[model samples]
Target: MMTTIAAAVAAVALASCAGPGSAADDAGERTLTVYAAASLTGTFEQIAADFEAAHEGVSVELSFAGSSDLVAQIQQGAPADVLASADTANMDKLVDDGLLAGRPADFASNTLTIAVPPGNPAGIASLADLAGDDVQLVVCAPEVPCGAATERVEQAAGLTFAPVSEEQSVTDVLNKVTTGEADAGLVYVTDVRGAGDRVEGIEFPESGSAVNVYPIAALGGSEEPELAQEFIDAVLGADGQRVLTDAGFAAP
Candidate 1:
């Protein structure tokens, strides 16, 4: 009895040292790293949770930023398993560099919108209102996907707006408007929907001129390429498309 008890205690100690969590947990569990555009945060977060539930022992770690910034990070050797861009242009940059393991699949599309604070205090009703001198407008930097889309809208509408601030990400533009730091901001239609009642979205005809097509791909150098590919598949599949559409993203 003493010998058996001693062996059991030894086993417990060894198991305890195997991981930082539960003793029964496998130390080699896969962590799929996803670098995605900031616009995808809410939907992707939900997808990650569902993915974790569906694939035991696999967890997803997401890094969200502007599509351009994410691409720059990947180019500079960030440890990313998958890349999801808010627009095809940024995704193409990585694919052209041979950083992707497979062809990037277009997952969804989005269009621009004017996000204003509750009640639209500034009374912003159209794209022209954004160019008003008294209106403090915020927008993503021109290099960002949303910014590029906004530029296209401007060209189509034959109007120009001088924004008070140019943000790094669409999220930042939304934050400014939601927090009353700016009167209005240009962001995606999905972003305005995601913001709920914090901001009111105004649609203009010009938005249709420039739509952004989002794409996702597994990185060529991913440590767990299979897991990364599976993750991409999950995002482009029925379940993932449901979550995205529910969040206001258009089917690709």
Candidate 2:
């Protein structure tokens, strides 16, 4: 009976000595979730990896999809600490919806390019070639930021394109062209650059008429508001800018 009482007293003493900063309290407590547009996949992944390296005991969870689709998910109560959009319009929508914890900031800009299979299978030398009836084309749906930019470019160039298929994400459009499902597609220059030799990019002057501005913000009601802001700061800081520019994105 004395032995059991002594053991209980020792356990109470140990518990009383444990501080609020105990190791057990911190283990696996640092997790941040970021929802980003599909166009930002490559760079954002690199950023997340680097952030994890810099901050010990922290992990970053990323969700990549179309800007519009991501916003819709947030609206439907998906769990995320931060949001990065492919365009300002989508971020504005979220801001208007009162879904953001802070004001969104522009970080980068991207322009559309014509992506054709390697060796220019369709002989697509310019944007005009994508309009030929015989040339099968894939594009993002008009609701997507890339597709919205495509519409602006179309209006400026006075060209009407009847795509064989419209995907929900720019990556999907790129995949369709690369897989030979479509002869060509309208995608970001970064996607073409990222694809390397898989696809050839055709530059057009009209592309300058429509450019996408990417924005990011902390989401409201985040479980880790401080960590979310730190991640956002990392993205807007020098290291993040370097990674983005190296990935074919232009500085904002």
Return the top candidate by lDDT.
Answer: 1
Give per-residue lDDT, candidate 1, residue 125.
Answer: 91
lDDT of each: 0.93, 0.92
Clashes of each: 0, 0
Q: What is the TM-score of each candidate against the true structure?
A: 0.92, 0.92
Write out the backbone clash pairs for model 1: none
Q: Which stretches of candidate 1 lie over 4 Å from their true place?
A: 1-24
lDDT string, candidate 2, 198-243, tens digits: 9999999999999899999999979999999999999999999999
Instruction: Give the lowest summed-lDDT range of ten residues in model 2.
Output: 20-29
